[model samples]
Target chain A: MTADISLTPPDPKDFLDTDSLFDEEERLLRDTVRDFVRKEILPNIADWWEQGVFPVELAKTMGDMGLLGMHLEGYGCAGTSGTAYGLACLELEAGDSGIRSFVSVQGSLAMFPIWKFGSEEQKQEWLPRMAAGEVIGCFGLTEPDSGSDPASMRTHARRDGSDWIINGSKMWITNGNLAQVAIIWARTDEGINGFIVPTDTPGFEAHEIKHKASLRASVTSELSLDDVRVPDAYRLPGVSSMRGPLSCLNEARYGIAWGVVGAARACFEAALDYSLERQQFGKPIGSFQLTQRKLVEMMIAVNRGMLVAHHLGRRKDAGTLTPHQISFGKMDNTRNALEVARTARGILGGNGITLEYPVFRHMANLETVYTYEGTNEIHTLIMGQALTGIEAFS
Target chain B: MQVVVCVKQIPDPSGTYTLDPETHFLVRPDEQVLDDTDRYGVEMGLQIAQAHGGSVTLVSMGPKGSMQGIRQALAMGADRAVVVDDADLKGSDALTTAQVLAAAIQRTGFDLVITGTESTDGYSGVVPQMLAELLDVPALTYATEVEARDGKVTINRQTSAGYDVVEASLPAVVSVTAGVVEPRYPTFKGIMDAKKKEVEELTASDLGVDTSLRQRVTAVEPAPEREAGVKIEDDGEAHLKVVELLQQKKVI
Candidate 1:
């Protein structure tokens, strides 16, 4: 039976109501994902972290909820708008960067290339399976010897008739071992290109990265592809050079710009609420000047990051954004979010160090964040070069 | 079943929309989402469509801003949306708004229509019945259970006493209050699908509005001031005293 809609308009203040900026559909989707994250990911986040196991079920759950490839339109994707895509990242990362990383690897790194850069057959063969969570995808770029500088990687691919053989190793790959397909970045005769290398392919192996203190709930893997042969059709047609891998970075980094803010928000809100509720010296710690200052500072950072990401998102949607602009957002927001997480940990005192509180987990996750997706120094150099017309990285 | 759900975008309740000094009466459009009561109406429309294998077309009468409510309905799995937008329709009184909706209903050829018992802004409970009058259709107010089986609408109406179930034929209108079935939360995927759904827009002229009909808002503002309360200690004695006070005030 249909429930009577109380048209008595709710006091708009009751909901987040990001309606004007987003269409009704997008805003509602944002809220729905937000609510799901809050209910599903937040409560068990610490437990999963301390145990050194991601709620592996979380990925499948997210996929079941149609969170995977939320922005890629059609082809079994939710085909959400840019804002919805951003907000989903925000909510997911609010739980932990590791969980966010899993999604990033699966969507931007894996599914996106096949959809945007791969052949039609590749898209048809992979998209539905990826969308259904029947198959997972990961991107292989950062080599073991290379962290910030992927362009200098030694991974290479050679053509043999209708097949190409690849021999390379990728490090710091999220969802690596668990994924069915890996969009391996390798130096080909055509320069750096992408190949859809299945994890089950001959001479392909991915072992889960072990003993990681940061992003513990995330499944990080290192991949070794030795003489892994795939058909020529597996090559990404939309990409001919280094730009292919770099484009994936552009996508991941944009999500990180929004994702890290969620990290900061979780830390800041945790500190704010904890400080208010945790009593010290016969009053709430939030009543103390030092604590209040930290909270206020964190708030300023989070809010500022939100505003910056919002504009960057608008520019992206408007088709006016450039790689340099994206770098600026990623750099500024990740740095601020890392600082916020650290300070939030400080406010929590001894309790902050434990996985029981979100502060420490977020703080540790930000360490990985500060280094990934172009790195802090890389972004700075990109912006510097854009400003002065000088390539400082060289 | 061609079910039409009337929704309005109002202020976020938490915002406590303050009135604009110049225009009065919470001048800015309520931080808009689906009207709470009207959301139930939307769900009812969708439910009817789901069970009967028909289309649910969500409609709203307000400024273009009202499209948010329509989109929300669409995300709730409504098949389509119709938006009635116009400048003169701004701050429309209940009767004039009903006339506009009645005309739109005629154009759309609706089989069944559902609405909230009252709008949150003015809490005006006149719309559904007034709209029914304009359309010359049978209207049921405060419906609890609405069952459409074999060309008959069996409605259980909530009254001051309890409930009164009645049967009505096709082309009927109903208003529902709270205590209906639990409304479903908009799923993330549902919202994603809604973006692809079409939201067709209509205007006051399309609704065949009479400009002569009153559209005046001389003053609008927030509720009256609330007095400060005494700070009660979080102790057993204080708690007991609070309980006693509640009992004394007949609130227990």
Candidate 2:
């Protein structure tokens, strides 16, 4: 006899039971981070976004919850599974992409470099404090002149008396103003080098990028290094090429693959809620065929994005993840999420324009998400290069 | 100080609920979670144990699947847990549940027992008192605050007006009301570590408690819905109708 098959309808919230893919600890981690977001971040996020400020105090709170560098081992880090880290990112971004960006920059970009490539002394001196959020760190690589091509970066470091004096500027640096330490990448005689530069050093300056639009709740700044000198002991000795910074970027891109799913889910949820309650033509808007089509499309995209992100996370944990795979995930998920957000915005109509609902805010944030950490076009080319053995970059 | 927190796995309160007409009992969905109300007690137990230099152990009785909810308490920093799960223990009443829990607590041993005033799903509000009676300990209910020190426990018992300070010696049961302490979110490390923590599972026979339920839910009926409000249209002198209605209701 055949086993009984119970074909139940999918849960609207999790349409595919994609949640079951995660183990117990991973699910608990997601729920805990979700709870923290609901209680702490969601209530005050709109105000913070409007004021163009991120509450830096949240770093220590997240640190206490072991969210900072939570996936790393040793030095006060939580050492959670890779999928757990991805799930945490998903929940954090569900609140706001800016919040998840803060965590991604801290954990994947900042701490991962020191843990993966820094000297024993460097890790000993900085990892614990950074993990505790007692000290904040930022990664500096992209410059005003270089967005997609790091090989064209103008920032260079010259050796002088067993010390390095870096004199260049970095643009679009996250956590720049708040970081106590910075992982500054500079071109050198040895191809490229990573420096552990203290933000308090003389001649090193950070100016907050101000004015209109996207990721306003996040601290983006420009760093001007006018002969910022550091001892040789401050340098990461593990490698001397673009590999050092590229690896860090790769790690961050993995998190982004998972994070944007949250942004999409949030917008989708808001639209669904609005559609049900909002009345048009003497009935709920959700009852309309056109509105249902949008909702169904959103649901499919979110479920598909979650599957992609989770698959990438598993591959990463198994040590089989490739750069092209990361690019595929980041590019596809971000594009899908942005589309979902835009569709959700249209569903909300006039209310979608206001910050009272999260739809507009998410749409605005997804624009930055789509552009940063290897822009959609760059990632698309990277995927194209993988599929066909051809050099696409000029 | 050894503390035991009595917790239960219940249906997700936020989800849609239904009742079985034949059994006259609420149908439990496949999605079950740690009852939100029990977090207050778990937090209280953790706090007392942390402050007094002892470990907190969670004691629960439910289906074997209840481990999902039990691990949640463990993730909140409880040292370990004892879960009594038996197929025959299904449809247990408050007294039956108390008997099973009392046996588990006896086997686990506790200097103090902490529990919520009632579970969110089945709010009988009598399990803690029954468990206290079964264990032959002082039952302190509706405690807004509890302090265990010097081989005695003191509680700020919430009353209708304000609160009363009630004290009892060691080995007491304190059912904390919500807001006694804000439940802490489980840290990432705690969540991972909880997987490794020991959760000793037992059956009714293993705990050696009687499985016979003394109370039965005979019939269930939905409460009557509220009557629609009186809608008086404004015919320029609607204030007179409102005043007259209030006068009939003796409010004027």
Best-matching candidate per lDDT: 2
Instruction: Name the runs in model 2 displaced over 4 angstroms.
Output: A1-6, B228-252
Give the CA lDDT, 0 to 100, for residue A312 in model 2: 91
lDDT of 2 by residue, A1-394 (tens): 9988768887888999998898777777888899899989999999999998988998888997899999899988999877888899999999999999999999999999999998889999999898888999999999999989987888889999999999999999999999999999999999899999999999899999998498878999999999999999999999899899999999899999999999999999999999999999999999999999999999999999999999999998999999999999999999999999999999999999999999888889999999999999999999888889886986
What's chain A's TM-score in each predicted model?
A: 0.93, 0.98
Weakest 10 consecutive residues, lDDT, candidate 2 chain A? A22-31
Q: Which prediction has the highest DockQ against the true structure?
A: 2
Candidate 1: tens digits of C-alpha lDDT, residues A1-394? 9999766753311122233556555566776677667777888888888777767666666776677876787677877666677878887898889888888877887888888898888899998778767788889989999777778989999999999999989998888878888899899888888998888998999999999989988888999988999999889989878788888888889999989989998898888878989998999999999988887789888878888788888887887889998898899999999999999999889999988888899999999899888889999999999999999988
> How would you encode candidate 1's per-residue C-alpha lDDT over B16-49 as one tens digit per residue?
5666666554554633667677768877887888
DockQ per model, Cα: 0.31, 0.76
Fraction of native Cα contacts kept in each candidate? 0.60, 0.96
In CAPRI terms, model 1 is classed as acceptable
Give per-residue lDDT, candidate 2, residue A144: 98
Give interface RMSD, per candidate.
2.8, 1.0
Off by over 4 Å in 1: A1-29, A51-67, A70-84, A128-134, A277-284, A318-320, A350-357, A384-394, B4-29, B35-52, B59-67, B80-252
